[model samples]
Target: MNREAIDILVHSAWKLLEAKDYLGARELYTQGLKLDPFDATLWNYRSNAHMKLQHPELAFTDAARGLQLLDDKLATTNLSPEDRNFSVFMKIDLLFRCLLAAENLDICQTALKYIDRLLTNSHLLSNEARQTILSKQKSLKLKIKTKRHAFARASDSLRLNLNDVLNLGTMRITKYPWNEFEPFNSENDIETELKEINIMLEPIAPKLLVVRM
Candidate 1:
């Protein structure tokens, strides 16, 4: 397709997206992408369409490509500060979403790198937007740390439980002193013994308070 045709497709796609017809917009974006594979703006638009269509993976890939193209253009020192700042902001925002969608530690790390660069020019961003980004960064960091700590605690609990079971087995073996004794004898006998033991230990267990609704 020619430039005019690509422009027409992009315009129609934007209209469809505004109308919340994601499938139609996606089709138009796909067509436009076919005609202009290297157009960064078209890729960004396509990514928005994909996101509205609940295709996170495709959206992330397109966003990354758009950011790459933008980065290439902004690499020259001739660009105005405003233009460079805008490009950097867009890259940071896109990288943040891509990191969230991908849920990879490396992606999150990369996103933070861009975010830090953006924050260095925080004066350029609106107060609300800057605060929002800072909040998100704080929340993500907290979540990662919380998950790591919880996983460590769970691992410790599992190890303790395993050790307790092993110690119990050893005690039982010492009490029987022979494999031929058949300590359990049957499932019903084992259940009965367990019930008795639980009853004996019931008083020591933590009590639950009843609450009236």
Candidate 2:
């Protein structure tokens, strides 16, 4: 491995990352990877750059690769205590990045897997970060449950709306779309007439309300 050159690239990329120049950092990391693709640190940081750029799939892939590399190192090679601790730290961070990317991809199950794996190392985390992961696990469980329930009822003609989703976690049936109307085209303002009628009814409808007396 061309360690010296890779170190320079990694250092330069870190500076770019700190400056929020994600693309520049990505480019530098890519160059370093070309020299030494096995550098788990480079892959992890590049995964972070991919995430910052909103490329979830790329971020997840790179993070997975980084974790695999780190795992291999920890399994096969004996290292100093300091080195082992740092590698474990990197492994946990890669899992975190993978979890975030999976969530962005709407693969909640994958996110849960990564979160579960992370919690096993909870002792290494600060209280705040550990709490955040626990909260995320709770959310992922609810999300998975909601998704499964919704999917079971989904059909070719049935469309999902915000209320349909919001209703899943609660027992009470929600009044979705208090008024159901035929779908109206919005580009030409097809609902303008109905909107006007509704506005006109605003005054009369209240008058129709019965009093307890």
Candidate 3:
């Protein structure tokens, strides 16, 4: 890798990123990666570009590769505490992007697994970032749970009587003429009352009131 070229690429790519030129930054990042495929920072930045373009699968892939490279570097290299912490933070942030990029339940579950693993080692993160990740984790868990139960809830609703199934008790129609009949109840009750009234009027059907001139 040419150090001078990498410096130029990094500088220009960062400027492009700041300017929201995600495609331009991505191209530079890709060029950088060809020179140093093991560069985790390049991977992370490239992932960012992909995310901005809504290329979730590519973003997730790059982010995951970045994490692997970071872990390998941490194990073999004697990095300063600040540098190590920053790398870890970047990885966590990338994990969040991965979560956001998830397009389906399976992908979401996979992202959750990675997130939970990082969260379990919360000491690797700053307090503020840790809290943010925890809150997001909780929200994601709730979203997944809700999605999983949605069908069951829909089916359960099928068994429900929207009108009256809670046994909330019936209302009364004791207002004026309505009081002459029974209280307002179920539809079945109303139908029964109508049937009884029709039965009582069966004989009256033949009677007619006539007028003579």
Candidate 4:
């Protein structure tokens, strides 16, 4: 296909994507890719469509390929500051989504590095975008920390007493509400009651394992 035809297909893909017709977008992207396999923009759009379709692994693969192609193109050409900043942000955003879906902490950390670079170099990003990046970075850091803490706690529990660990796990698996509490009238009240119970019982619940140990 000619460049003009490729452009038309790309534009059609964008229109379909804007309309939230991801499958239609993907079809257009596939046609574009057939004509221009190394078109980074088409690949990126295809990745977005795949993500919307809940195909995270395929999305990540296409995003990575697009970024690689873009990087090569950038190395040879001098892009304007605004264009460079936008491209970097898009790459980082794609990586962040892919990492989150994969639960890959290392990839998330690498994406944060790009976010920091964008924040340092670009003044064009809106305050909301900056805040959102900061929020995502903070959330990923907390998730990694929480996983590490849970692993450490489990290890310590097992080392301290095997029977206690087993009983604790069993209790967690078996415990169920017996309907002693009234039906929650509102979401807020339900959340408040659950939070209170969690806070109050968390420390005392471990003691139950002592008897089993």
What C-alpha lDDT does candidate 1 achieve relative to the native structure? 0.61
Q: Which ten residues in a row are the worst by lDDT in model 2?
A: 171-180
Residue lDDT tens for model 3, 114-141: 6787777787678987787778678778
Instruction: List per-prediction Cα lDDT, in the order shown.
Output: 0.61, 0.75, 0.65, 0.61
Leading candidate by TM-score? 2
Order of all candidates by lDDT, from best down to worst?
Answer: 2, 3, 1, 4
In model 3, pairs of residues that clash are none
- Distance from true position, residue 2, model 2, in Å? 1.8
Ranking by TM-score: 2, 3, 1, 4
Q: All candidates: CA RMSD in angstroms?
A: 22.3, 19.1, 27.9, 19.1
Q: Write the per-residue lDDT of candidate 1 for residues 1-213, one digit (tens) a residue.
A: 378999999889889988999999988877876776656677677777777777765666666666667777777889899987777767766655554444332344444554676677677778897887798678667775675577667778566554333223111111110111123223466555654554455466522111111
Model 2, stretches more than 4 Å misplaced?
Answer: 155-213
**List of clashing residue pairs for candidate 1:** none
What's the distance in Å from true for residue 210, model 2? Answer: 67
TM-score of model 3 relative to the true fold?
A: 0.61
* Winner by lDDT: 2
Off by over 4 Å in 1: 77-114, 156-213
Query: lDDT tens digits, residues 1-213, model 4?
Result: 468998898888888888999999998887877777666677778877888898765565666666666666667658898877667666655544544434332444445554665567446567887787678778768865675577668788456654343333321211112112212222466555654574466576622211111
TM-score for model 4? 0.59
